[model samples]
Target: MKKWLIYTFAIAILAVLALQLFMFSTIQQQKNSDEKYFNMAKQEYKIFVPYIPDSLELFGENVPVDHVLVRERLENEIVRNMYWHSHTILLLKRSARYFPVIEPILSENGIPDDFKYLAMAESELTNAVSPVGASGVWQFMKSTAQEYGLEVRTDVDERYHLEKSTNAACRYLKASKQQFGSWTLAAAAYNMGGGALKRDVDAQKTNDYYSLLLNQETARYVYRIVALKLICEQPFQYGFFIRNKDLYQPIPVKKVSVSSSISSLVDFAAEYNLSFLELKNVNPWLRSDKLVVNTGKTYEINIPLSFSHTKLTENIADPYTIFKDSIVVE
Candidate 1:
């Protein structure tokens, strides 16, 4: 009996050891698998690339990095914009389409090239509407847009119209530059009202935008613009990479004059071989599917002759898919 009991006990102990060995092997295999996946995922995602320059310029005006606060402010902006990758990437992609339109307009109006950065800072180079009803790439408040000759109405909101709004922005910038005597101050005024900027300058006894101790948004405004300018110009340097195929392209469109109401934009788009959704996509200022025209007032409607790859229909499997040369509508 004692011998039988010893045999049973020994066998049970060996079985327990075998079970433990099996579990150990399984657990180790799982750990190895996890490590492999972790390494793969790590290779896919990168983090924290920023290039903080010692000095920078905007419209031929230099940021005096010699000042500790100014240098620190710039450093803050560089880090903020660089790591905030998603927003910055969208802005970069949109720049391919919008910058061509904005550049020529800026040059034509005698506005400094650096002012394009200001527009980017204002509205991310998009027709983004603000919390307080400021609209468009320029973030024009309805009142201010009207003051600059942008017609704001229920039916026709020109603030959302890119070219018209840009012209208005140039006029406003020119006026502000005349008032402030410096591009820096002019940009600062754009954010926190010319009156507020003037008050701050007078109170602080300085005309410099950086020197004036202002509110947070106004304070960081110039630094943000300058940082964006640097990162966008050298996107690869800051670890932002979009393949040429993935970048958004502008659609080629011809101007169509309309002196009559468009009762149904759906029908109007079909006439031009465009989708209703796409019509709004390019002409965002068209608030509704209908347009009511007044006598003697001719509205220029931009009818796209070609489609860009931005339209992501299921049939359009290729991300690089884009229409060839557009036919200009006479």
Candidate 2:
């Protein structure tokens, strides 16, 4: 019995020692892992604050970046867009495809070319719908779109029509400019309605957009546009390093005019050697699967031109360089 007790005590001591050794080993391994992780983090990780340009302008109006509040507001947008890699990268790619379409329309309307960035600010150059029922790249509400000559019907919403919406936006901006007497104020009025903006101006006794205390969204509106303008104009300087080939190329398309209704877009697409998805992609303005044309109305459906992958690749080039001559910089 004494031998048994002695043996059991010896076994218990061995078990405790084993457990202690195992725990020590585990603690040592964790310490080494932590040390390695700290070393790697110290060597490799970095976050950078972007440089702010001394001078900035939007639509020929000098942004009051000299003012501390103005500078900080602009910096906030720049930093947000700069660090937001996915969103900004997509913006760059999409701008390559859509800017070519928007620039000409703005020019023809005698609107400042800088307003293209306003469209970017509005919808990221996409046919986006807002929560309050504003739709399109310009984010025009139904009444506003119709007022500006867009057809916002049950079957057809031209707000999604890129060219037409851009034209409508141009008209609106021009009218806003006339009402406000400055492009900056016009941009502000575009975000908050003209009536609301005018009320704010009168209440504050200030015609200056920067000076007038306004709603949060309206206050930040122009700054966002200016920030986008700066980054788009100098993407590389802002740390976006998109290659020419990486940029989205504008799809080649031909217009098919139809005075009559299209009974089935699927059939219509097949007639043009396209899939329904492809047809819809090119013509998002076509709301319904079918079209109804009144006696005097006509619609133009865009049909993408067929090209081999090699041929398409051969046409890929830097949009900035290609459209540089066309872009009017003030």
Candidate 3:
């Protein structure tokens, strides 16, 4: 009887342990399933949804962005970028600083204000380079830069020179507009050549930019430009907030024109009461350490007129602190 009681107690204990193990495993499985389901639901919510504009027909013959496929893609990008709130805000802050420099150049060239968005699309207003050797905010390749009257060589690359590059871009845009007879088409041709665009229009028997089939990059190019314009122009609507001080401002500089060869730029800068870095910062086009004077070419070097030695010695407590940070080099 004692043996039987002992055996029964052991059996009961084993049964309880098995039951507990089964219950625990089942609860774990339920928890995993619940987590998976929640994740799946969250992903589903992120799917692209196109904003349907009433005048869809106005964009006729244009690639249908409002269509199910295009809308999904656009919505995906918009949402992904919108949720990336920090980056958008930074872009806004930077634009304020750079637009002043860009706008006047465009206006002087008679190019539309809308074209400012091209730089935003090209380089995000930062000096950027491409795999094919395009460089600067305008992304000019070697041949293109040369064709547009920009000197691109071992020492001097005018593509980094914002004023010169903007001038070149203006000339190109004006020529394109004359060829295409439309600002919209001219803007498109800036990516694809005006002649090629003309041929495409002829082949498609449609003058409408959106109606004809184009390569993926070219097709999306205008829309991307327009999207950037809309977003940057109305930052509050797109949820980008920035302060005036956060925007970049152009530095004050004095211009000194030199027609003769500068044997030593360092000496020349010191003569004018400026540093070599300051001289190079203002005139990025002067590529060489020693300026080989093109006898006919009159080169203009910019010097900072604001920083006088007397003012600094009297007013500035820490001259070391002032020189520590990098001044605008390009």
Candidate 4:
């Protein structure tokens, strides 16, 4: 009987030990779960959001941001450009290369400084061609480019040349400013047409750009420009931070004049110790393999002063930091 009692006591001790272990494990699991939730809460609440400015201007005209719709629009763009790190950073880099070329042209033509942002909006400072044939930084249609004295031909298209195209854009914008009597409306005219904007103004009996109801592109046009203007000025505020050296530098080139018909552009490029692709890449205006030149026209082609054996045709770097970080060399 004493041996039986001892066995019961041993079994009771084992049950108590098992209960303590299970309780310890349950408490440890709950502690781990609490720590996980706490970390998530910290991350979510710690993010900083930019605030809207009380007042703003575009092309020297005051933005009616006090209005509910206007405030929402500005806030929307700030969020877009702020959070869109890759695209905006690319623009920030490209702007460093292209803005220097375009800014002085705007000043020379008596256009407002703000209009450079218009180019940023139109093409992201790229040599992009629109589906409707609007080409270059300013996205000018072929007919409009021709109307502004740009050569829109098969063999020689000046619209691709940065300086010449920017000058042409200045002319168009200057004319729009003249017709509209306000640079704000002038900008809207660029997206739609000056005729359309003017007709809408007259029919609606309003000259205020902010008050009129425009088609989607024209309506959001000025807002987009303003958004870009703010971001370019304050890149750090919008989360795009870059060193000055990170921006693309403009290549130095020497210009050669071609007056007569060139039967072979390949031979022309070879004369400068450059490949045909190199010549065409720098001067994208050269459309065909051969350049056909008639009387009363002289074309100038720019050749890079120096290049490395590594790159055949120089192009801008990708400028995306995330992509730059991911590259692993073998």
Q: What are the Cα lDDT values of the candidates?
A: 0.82, 0.85, 0.67, 0.80
Q: Tell me how far the alpha carbon of residue 134 in candidate 1 is from the true structure, in angstroms, after superposition.
A: 0.2
User: For model 3, which pairs clash?
Assistant: 61-210, 61-211, 62-210, 62-211, 63-210, 97-248
lDDT of the structure predicted as candidate 3: 0.67
How much is the lDDT of residue 216 in candidate 2?
A: 97
Which segments of model 1 are wrong by more than 4 Å?
1-49, 308-330
Candidate 1 TM-score, true structure as reference:
0.79
Score candidate 4 by lDDT: 0.80
Tens-digit lDDT track of model 4 for 116-136: 999999999888998888888
Candidate 2 clashes: the total is: 0
lDDT tens string, model 1, 4-96?
Answer: 999999999999999999999988767743355445445756776466667678878988878999888888998888888788888888887
Model 2: per-residue Cα lDDT at residue 158: 94
- Per-residue lDDT of 1-330 in model 3, one digit per residue for the tens? 999999999999999999999999998767753355445435544423334343322111233555675555445545545566676665665675577788999988778777777877777777778887788878888888899999877656789888889889888888987876667677778877777899998899876665668777777776666566556655434543332333444556777888887788889889987788888876777677778766588766778766544542444333222122222111
Between prediction 2 and prediction 4, which has the larger lDDT? Answer: 2
Please give, for residues 161-204, the per-residue lDDT of candidate 2 as tens digits: 99999999999999999999999999999999999999999999
Best of the two (1, 2) by TM-score: 2
Residue 276 of model 1 has an lDDT of: 94
User: Highest TM-score, which number?
Assistant: 2
Who is ahead in lDDT, 3 or 4? 4
- What lDDT score goes with residue 310 in model 4? 32
Better lDDT candidate (1, 4): 1
User: Residue 36 of model 4: what lDDT?
Assistant: 49
TM-score per candidate: 0.79, 0.82, 0.66, 0.77
Better of 1 and 4 by TM-score: 1
